[model samples]
Target chain A: MSTDPTANFSGDIAGDILTTALDWKNAGKGVALATVVTTWGSAPRPVGSQLAVDDEGKFIGSVSGGCIEGAVVTEALDAIADGKPRLLDFGVSDAQAWEVGLACGGKIQVYVERLDS
Target chain B: MKREILEQLQADRADKRPVVLATFLKTGEQRLLYLVGKKGLKDLDPRIGEAARAALIEDKPRTLDTEQGPLFLNVFNPPLRLILVGAVHIAQALVPMAQLAGYEVIVIDPRSAFGSVERFPGITLSNDWPDEAMAQLRPDLRTALVTLTHDPKIDDPALIAGLKSDVFYIGALGSKKTHASRLERLTAEGFGPDDFARIHGPVGLSIGAKSPAEISISILAQMTAALRQPAATPASSSAAA
Candidate 1:
């Protein structure tokens, strides 16, 4: 357990993840945030996970799905369309990723977009 | 929705409201440590001293390697979340598990018989279709969604809608055979076969789970794994495309 004094994990990641995003959003900068909302069988994660990305192909945070991130990054690019927030998803509600990633363990969905100022 | 809460946390940070973010990282021993703060970010950790300050107090994202393994520094300015799509018997099991995992869970279901405050006590309850009720709840990168409804009428449309949005983990309950049938139907409705393959059919791993409640445990366990680690393997869709 990292009980480091003066270290705040809550504010840093949350801040680092959103600070630039919100700044870009406020400055009318193009930014996208993709998050994991659900999962299915054999997945390595739970729901309520996230991954943040930008139009330039820069990224922070994890859509958290291991290898499928490349695909999710593609979705983040789509979110940059017209600079509006949009949703993106990968995997099935109950099916598994056989060839692409892992099988019966993915089924992840994400929301992407240029942060609303 | 998990995003709403995360948004609130963001607002709290912008306003410098009191908040804390805790993540269970797999470190040298996979220890459970919470990063607590609301701007001051000091005096939060009891182990704080002048020597270990550099490791703990740094003005950047961190990755700490402990005796167990690598400790992933997950930020949570406003705490954690819990987004539930169904209010069923299995949910009864998941809600507690989520809360135990340090999440604030909110459940949604349209059926009154299934979604009742009486049944799900001490948790946020919303009686609405999973798809329609999404707007009411907000989910973010830090948020996760767990759909336990086995009924396609409730699960499918909601899932399709979720598929198009930014919510993590769209889990549904069904067997491999049931999933195959569902996949055929989805393909008939224009969903690509590759797309259909994303679903975690049978809902949970083949841990030999039988009942709904037991399935819920298996499913939640899987969800926890998804959160704790990176997606197991990378997909090769480009090869197919």
Candidate 2:
């Protein structure tokens, strides 16, 4: 297997994430895609930002400024296992946000869905 | 998202097509909307189509409340483009600045001496005539055109092309008198007041700029304004340095 993160993908950042998800899925690895669908108050990442995760917990791209990727990755793994879509809300007010270190005081809603045929 | 839908979206993006993916947050259902060419929506909600078009024009992703549920309209607009009709000194300054602002800059000048590679190192240089180059480029909504060459032979064709196309910004560098005469000539060619109104003669903001670099800064600022705030009235064209 190629060690390059973008070995089979070539495009912009968003395109790369989608391409990676598809590539991982075709390779028989469970894949889930997480996208930042909405944001409020100084969110580091803009809406439509994406992250692609594999069942192995390997990931590419980001939905936050490295503040909530771990939690998102955990959700992505569960999504891949259950083949169920999930909407994750992370904000400064949420207790889960403190655990996930979303210390930027901004809020983001991420949509995580397993890539299905 | 389904594998086929993802593939189609990737294919559209690869082809530089402006597409919007509207996804229902509750059901994870997705529908692709194309800004140009064939209509992709059939038996779908018209409100979704309207919102998709609005999102495309705004060049931003947005969430819309719908009868079904909240829909996320993810806009995938092609990268912004800046086409310079003249590879003049101002263009030499503007090209790098526009590139830094995330515009894919293309310098078009038929004159081999003026549009040489040494003058615009690591830039896309086109020696085709302004009219020919504009036709080939087919400036779209995400593109901006500027005519920097004072010569009517070069700038006029470019200005005409810019007026005919969907380019968001059309700027020409000249004095007020020159602009008047240029407008007169264009008017003689059957262009109306609305077409002339679209051209930003004496291009650039009313910054007291005399040097080529400063003038480039002003022009880029005007382009940024035209892009980000499309609804706002453009700055008056009288204050050209």
Tell me the tens digit of each residue's lDDT in model 2 across A1-117: 111212222336454777788888889988899988888898888888889999999999988879999999999999988888899999999999989999888999999998887
What does candidate 2 score in Cα RMSD to the true structure?
Answer: 4.6
Candidate 1 deviant stretches above 4 angstroms? A2-117, B1-60, B63-79, B188-190, B193-197, B211-213, B233-241
Number of the top lDDT candidate: 2
Count clashing pairs, candidate 2.
Answer: 0
Instruction: Judge candidate 2 at residue B228 and give its lDDT.
Output: 80
TM-score of chain A as modeled in candidate 2: 0.86
Off by over 4 Å in 2: A1-15, B235-241
Chain A TM-score (model 1): 0.66
CA displacement after TM-score superposition, residue B30 of candidate 2 (Å): 0.3
Deviation of model 1 at B236, angstroms: 14
User: What proportion of the true contacts does each candidate reproduce?
Assistant: 0.15, 0.62
